[model samples]
Target: MTATAHETVRDAGRALGIPDPVTEAFVRLLRPCVYPCLYEQLPEESRKHAGPAARAGGSAHLPVDVVVPAYVPHLVTVDCAAIPTDVLDIDFPADGHVAILAEITDQDAGFAIHVPAGTETVERRPRETEPDALKPCASFPL
Candidate 1:
């Protein structure tokens, strides 16, 4: 079964034009990082779905924020110092998007961060719900 899953992943990676070695390396990295992050939320028996599933659960759990830094040369800052140190920063490369899953309680409403895209900016909307605009695809399930 393990071998079959590995083959499935490898085949999918190949179909997407990723080399076998790179795909293997990514699988190695995600295996260690992804589970531990989810585990931090709760014990195994009481565990809900991680990543997007948790985000879809709405007010019952934390909201997942996807931060996509522009490709042009500039800085896109995300400061979470006001929040607890444990949930401070989400590490993502400048060229990639990072998913930040945070648990909001009744005592605290939400935190603010200023995300700038070059010289232009957009108005802020409700943070909890996904926008009504057209989506490229349905949520990417892990």
Candidate 2:
């Protein structure tokens, strides 16, 4: 079976004698490679701007499978809350693009849907910018 990104990197770390923290940092930096779908699925309004960073209250952490076309697939966790107003005003796009976390069979493959199965439609809410708003929203059991 194909290894998870963490396992793949960890194996490389062991072979190269890289520290755990360094390997982890590398993984984090490379994590966004899977999110190209985010840009593609962005509301037309948000596509023209740079993607926003994860921030408190405005971001929801969901285990998503982002598949940028023609790239290696990713099964990384991402925060979908609090898109910057300057970037995009919406958080999770109501557009059906997120994939079902449980039904995701190919962790290393791209998902086709915008929203996956088993997710409730979240109510539209205003952004939360408080520093303390950085708590975990809903976490997928997967």
Candidate 3:
């Protein structure tokens, strides 16, 4: 029910280990700052099949945030810049991933983040194959 592959990726060079304390520390700082800001895109952006709520709300209402906490770090925007609730979000660089989670709803699903395209990735997780291939998994419905 939690993010297995996601967590596994943290120790890419290693077989199975918790992400380093430094990485965890960064995660602590990063997750809360990003979730609220970026979660709104889940429904529309996900290529996976959307359920009834998405059909009713159109592509704009994917509710994937509820499950993110157990698996991924949640970062709410830290800036005091008065970001509109709609604009609050987290962005993931390549070799890393981010999720903007929605509050728990009847349905739960959200979008994953990485550099849009052709942008430099400053920070990335340790990986065996690629350093910055930040990919996200979907919560397939039961």
What is the C-alpha local distance difference test score of each model? 0.36, 0.41, 0.32
lDDT of 3 at 135: 37
Question: Per-prediction TM-score, please?
Answer: 0.24, 0.23, 0.18
- Residue 45 of model 3 has an lDDT of 57
TM-score of 3: 0.18
Clash counts per candidate, in order, are 0, 16, 22
Residue-level lDDT tens digits of model 1 in 49-105: 433221111111112353422211111122222222342235423321222323233
In model 3, state the lDDT of residue 84: 27
User: Which residues of candidate 3, in runs, are more than 4 Å off?
Assistant: 1-6, 13-19, 32-48, 51-142
RMSD of each: 14.8, 16.4, 19.4
lDDT of 3 by residue, 103-131 (tens): 34455534444323333433222235554
Best by lDDT: 2
Q: Could you give the candidate ranking by lDDT, starting with the highest?
A: 2, 1, 3
